[model samples]
Target: MGTMFYGDDSTALHFEDRALAHLKVVIATKLRRGESFTISWVHGPGEQRGRSTVWISPSIPLRFVFDDPEPTTLNPRYLDQLATSANSSGGIQLIDEDPVP
Candidate 1:
């Protein structure tokens, strides 16, 4: 599991590294274009176990940590889905995609 630290180093949102790699591309693209949007996710049955969402803008500090050193290639279809959400007024909602081997 990898953690995405936002605002401060102490608090973080965790996800699989492969999932995060895909998110990084979409998120970076949106932020690079000065677009701000919300991204939301629900915890699994274990762990914190709740839904959480955040507003993403250029000004906010964001960091992504991955367990695996290598990068995962983005699935174009999934990337398009996420990118569409990022561009939408409602914003992006991170969903589980099949993990890369």
Candidate 2:
């Protein structure tokens, strides 16, 4: 598992390592371009049944922590999906990866 510590509040949002890596790339790219956006995800097991969203901006303090120690190989398709959603009016909505056959 990996964690994204966002903003001064340091709210931790958990995600799988691979997914988080891809998100890091997309988010960094956006922030580098001076863009601020929102990202949301559905709650996982053992948490509340609703979804959560956060505003992401270059001014905010953000950190990504991975448990694997080694960096993950990012999937371009997933990155594309995330980037597409990030540009949307609704902002980024984290979606599950396609199941491997």
Candidate 2 per-residue C-alpha lDDT over 1-101 given as tens digits, one digit per residue, 9 for 90 to 100:
89999975458899988889888998999999999999999998988899998999899899999999988766778888999999998898999977443
Candidate 1 C-alpha lDDT tens digits along 1-101? 88888888987988888778888999999889998889888885677768888887789899999999988777887888888878887788787675444
What is the Cα-based lDDT of residue 53 in candidate 2?
88
- Model 2 clash tally, residue pairs: 0
What pairs collide in candidate 1?
A: none
TM-score, candidate number 1: 0.88
Worst 10 residues of 1 by lDDT: 92-101
